[model samples]
Target: MKFRRKHYTDDTLLALYKAILKPRLIEEKMLILLRQNRISKWFSGIGQEAIAVGSTMALQEDEYILPLHRNLGVFTVRNCPLHQLFAQFQGKPTGFTKGRDRSFHFGTQEHHIIGMISHLNAQLPVADGIALADMLANRNKVTLAYSGDGGTSEGDFHEALNVAAVWNLPVIFLIENNGYGLSTPNNEQYKCEYLVSRGAGYGMKAVQIDGNNVLEVYDTIVQLSAQMRENPHPVLVEALTFRMRGHEEASGTKYVPQVLLDKWSALDPVSNYEKFLLQEGILTEAVIAEIRALIKEEINVGLEKAFLDKMPEADTKQELQDMYKPFVQTAHAPANATKTEKRYIDAISDALRESMLAYPNLVLMGQDIAEYGGVFKITDGFVKQFGKERVRNTPLCESAIIGAALGLSINGYKAMVEMQFADFVSCGFNQIVNNLAKSYYRWGQHADVVIRMPTGAGTAAGPFHSQSNEAWFFHTPGLKIVYPSNPYDAKGLLNAAIEDPNPVMYFEHKSLYRSVAAAIPDSYYTVPIGKAVLTAIGEDLTIITYGMGVHWCLEILAKHPEIHADLIDLRTLLPWDKETVAASVKKTGKVLVVHEDCLTGGIGGEIAAWVAEHCFTSLDAPVMREGSLDTAVPFAPTLEQNFLPKYRIEEKIKKLLAF
Candidate 1:
């Protein structure tokens, strides 16, 4: 489909001139604020204003933009309130992030603009996911994702491009080749002749343009965007410009040569655009002065109002809870009175199947999740039942899977991401901890995603395949961690996680896949998150455990009934049932925390510390903790058994009883 080229009228020229001027003025104000110590740092887009303004102008109002820290012109072109921008840089309460973040790190949901983190290329997969959602919904919207030439070196950039190409997503990957990534020159960044040439390798249309030429950049993006809206194919646009300023205000460009700086300075995008407008006779001297005076007055007025705004209060307990709030589905009883005894793995499958049946917007993505039904057969027959579009088999790219799921969630789809093994979660740790975990706190965006991690040892799957990595995410805030032991809780917690608004790491222990079976309700129901279930109640002691540890504790209790103890299954590790644990601890006056993860930084230490601090007066003994030795999970069964065995737990119980 051929799109009519956009005609640049006097109004268009004036708009472009204003768009270029606004960001320059804003950057100048920010640098002033930085020198005055009113703002902490400033990332000036002084020289590359044309790319932000031109590309954004080409996009439809409803289209989404995932911008980088230096793309101030995108904000101005999108009409982001000047006062809010000032307030954000000033760290005032009226800022978009409520002063939680500063400078180009906040987004407005209403505007469909995603805030960015310092890890530059992370947004690429998210943009792909957003475009995927639009494609799935049959919408004409396209997504424009921005990155620096330096960010192209990241693995996420390649993964995102591959997924977008394979799926034919309507996403425009805009790489601002600003000659330098901080102090690193383009020569050191990549071996490619042109960054846009890499797009052909990914099976997408590609283009390289003089980024300083606003008219050319705007025309190229407008034509490509028009085609993408109908055909739904990814496009790569490499905008070649230069970073005229230091990386940030404080980082002086002393390392840059004087000759190169002078060469680029003469061709400054803002100044060149003004000159173009004058040559075209689109603007008179009086009109140019009017535009400058108007923008300066606007900036000054916004800064003054922002200065008067209050700072965020220090009381953050409630704020934290509000930021991490999960989506809750309406309560409903099971459809029938019938119950079925299902194994842990089968129950997980049932929960996913039922969830998809209920929520049309729910999508499952992972390696071999669709056609193969996952390696564990947990998603068996889902592709045939729900179609391949919903049950997707992603490339062996963990970072892209999790990052795209975050994007899907933001676009109003509930995404269920699967890690082939719990240990492999390390591959996507940056996205999980940095992007998914911090998105809500940094910007009020809900990542309604459920990450299914088939976890644990006992089967001796070795270090690469078998690991209880829950402790890694447990340390990160703005994430919900659910590790259910039995089939009943497995189905219910998985269902709850799918319904949640925040990102949830749902761990299904591989050891319990076929070994454990229980009667689960036939209809939909949710097990409340952050709640612990009491398998056994006793007055002598309380055993706090989750996942595989829950079964071990139950076995110990069954073997020695005389050892009166409360066996509590902490189904949710994060926001762990503190109330339930405190009540049990106060009654028993003795507590033991157990898990299969290694000892040093295991969640066992956190539980023990909590008991020591909160239940100190009631304690009859020091809080005992049991876990694997602080080393990589051994490959040999003999070593693994000695590391975390039922006998070791029993021995600890005997010592606690004697104490």
Candidate 2:
């Protein structure tokens, strides 16, 4: 039968209402707990319950719902125990998140809720990804995503909608227009009067509905969702509602005007629904009282359980110590693991080829990565071998490319996305910080992804192309950041990143792409993440570097043999190899950190801090750091060289010898 669009009838409304009200009562109790100082904080979906409940009701029991923080109502309807949610808010072990997720970012895989993400606009692309996975699995499930009106202003929002529309994915975007985002009113925040109108720009079927009216919301979603599941196309629904409270627990009624509250309070979803039910003879005043009593009981039981739950103990932490344990243990092996063989670009190509063969779910994507071999020719001829699906080429939209890559990752594909140039990554910053970095903590291992970007400054590509922006991502948590200085680490770490589960930002040095060469094994192998290599040993001082800086130091080392030095290459930054670095600094008793990124808040500062703490007692002198000056990387070779560290290993060794 062809899918028809319309609202749910009485029977469907009754089922959906029962599911939604249960969660609403829990939210109210959670708020009460916050007031009592029992829980830290919470963002309530008190006024806009229908949008979450009604929309989720349209989905199959097992279909994924990648909700924003405010959509706890959806998770409750999906059968996530109220106690587990309360415990999550309380940061207890029994919580759905296991006490890892930040408040508001909570849910569970067991409940078939993909999890709630705290990043404002991220759920849209993730929803697209869930739909893609369902489509690939040949499942009839659809993904429903709920976001606030404020989130619609984000670039990821447009990127997700565009990709979903083009691919005809099965996704339902529900925008809960909840009047205010923090303190900014909807009118002041966006030019558009209706958030749903933005969907039309992406060529999607969109509607604006009365979100406070559960009957209307249920009716609309029921009619639209069937078409989405049957044919697999994306649609949007703008739910117009009002906020009954401030943004979160920290926010009070001070910023909210009394008039708006009076107006909206009169239109509370539960009250309006009760009136509708009474008028339709579906419910009576006595039955409503009984329903409220039952809801209160449910909330009390859930709260009691949450209060008794314990936080994770030492054993649980010890058990998960190395959960994604390394397969190859070459720790005791000599530097014989290091080899001088293939060109750097060739190693990247080989890594991709080998990884593709090793993992069926690994995919390569970027502009011209297929037949064109990529602009730099790094991915030259990969499409002919891997096919267009795996080694795909995309349009010039960097945001769209990243947005789609995010979706692919959610669908259980490790997407190695290449930005034609390092500077172009700035265009997809939202995906990097808001989605990829925060996804793991938000979703509780629901999304693991990888992004491979070509970077660094030696090419005279000017200020626009040569900028080293690693600092932007280094500040973010839950993301693994890596920069390989040689072909061996490049291939090994790339393999590890693809094989492991987590979102990774892998930066390939543009200057070292073809200039460097090293030996690599044909057999599949991996270098451990968060491990640094002591490339050269000496007596004077240690030079901490990675990527192009590592190569530069090697050349400087050979020139000044008189002044002994040790070189340590930090392969990864987020979970840096502090142990290795501390040991190296202790041996040398002095340190100099180098990188292509700007001086302030760069990797150098990080290393210097580590030395000050762990290697302080061993140091003979104050640790120093060398990096590009605080300015745009100039196009002229002379200025660019000046911008970079002129104090190479030899110069540093000479200084250390004097010290």
Candidate 3:
């Protein structure tokens, strides 16, 4: 490898060859370790190194790259330290995830690499989000997202591509057609002649190339990336290649034809590239020997350090601290007295508007949230104030929107999403539980996004629209659940949720959106999350509730002056105010937990259990709990009224008092 110039400099060409060669050599060593049972698994990229190396090399260092699990060359070429990479694969403390996760299933901003989950296609929309941030900031940075032959068949693939093309983001979606998706042949993948044709259907520019040819991959990326930076649009590139080894050493390739393997062996990228370098007089026999020797030493050192490193501590203390991270906050002023009072929905909208003014990087994404002002007009006139770039009206792609919000969160932006109806959040459940909820625990990604959930039963919206499903997220760790029952708490909690570093599910009961009203300060203020509010004072009994449940308790107390009880409104559910609830439980010696969700799996059960365990001696009677019946919310007005806990909650309060 000597300094010289041709269509490309001899030094530059030699470096690309080494970068491409490194991962192949690493995979070869890993294969040996796998055979000996020294390592757990190996997803070999032996025959498909060129595309990873060339495509990554084409992007600027500041730009982002989301690589598939099989694309090890993308990491090596980006100068990700070999020792740390090996440690991560071996579950050592020095790994990127600090041994929290094993193998190449982790991501860090250090290498501009966003990690991939087991759900491969899920990362595509996340790529759009990173690019969306750069696009909004008017930065020339582009994102290159990789997917496999099988990933194109996933719903995320289509949704992500459509989002990118519709927004005209600077994204390069690369597909490495590596013959098989874990033993399922390409014939079973799709009907299209080539994966590149699918891009045309999305109205995106696309092309196909020989993935084996390093120069073709490199030159194509350089050309297309330059064009994208100038115009800022997305394009898809399909690279036809073959993986020499099985998907993993465990999953053998007996499913593939021997004749095909023999043919591809002849076009082995590493050996053929070395031959090309020799044929071009760019490298000598001595230099080739030096390159191989250098790689051998690096691999040996990386593996040695990884084997000697200490394993991560798995004690309760360490595990507890690893679940979430905190962020800095801005100061808040006390609310000013005003003659005008606001409704629950007004308070939420005001909180969002004020938060946007305070946090410049705050972006809002949802369906019909722009010109239509959302279904309930919570974001009315926001587009005019914040501009369409900040207030984006997204396609009805819940998975993509949520994934993009995570992408934005990691890239130094805050996003607030509206779930038209809380029930519809089921569409983006995977992204929420797997990606958003687990990002911090898996890696150190902050999910600084708020999902505004309009929930509860009313207006005959039926089972699909009126379900109160806060328990779904309550069951998942690393998420904050804030369900405000009135305007005062609504404003304060929404602001607090936006300021929180972790993912927050803000469930707003649609039935209380207009019915509930309170005199709240017109200025900015945040009610601390995880703190239950003492709404009413009494000695006879204690009532614990949130959201619409608070309204029922208050209504019953108002109708009967003799029924005095201390009402505790749990503003935040995940980090529930245990001290407040416990203290209240002890004061009254009689306790009842009420919630709008079904009784069987509702959060009310969890609260009741906690109270029973801690305040068993203080109880005057058995700890009581009440909730909606174990059934879907009904469609008819009368049936829906019967299904809700409002009517029976008063009777339950009377029963608890009588006990």
Better of 1 and 2 by lDDT: 1
* C-alpha positional error of residue 654 in candidate 3 after TM-score superposition, expressed in Å: 2.6
True lDDT of residue 460, candidate 1: 81
For residues 482-596, write the lDDT of model 3, one tens digit per residue. Answer: 9988898899889989989899999999988888788888888988888899999999999999988888898899999898899999989998999999999999999989999
lDDT per residue as tens, model 2, 166-199: 7788888888898888888888889987887788
lDDT tens string, model 1, 130-197?
99899889999899999899999999999999999999999999999988888988889999888988
For model 3, give the RMSD to the true fold: 2.2
Q: Estimate the TM-score for candidate 3.
A: 0.97
Show the colliding residue pairs in model 3. Answer: none
Name the lDDT value of residue 605 in candidate 3.
92
Worst 10 residues of 1 by lDDT: 1-10
> Would you estimate the TM-scores of all the predictions?
0.97, 0.86, 0.97
Which structure is stronger by lDDT: 2 or 3? Answer: 3
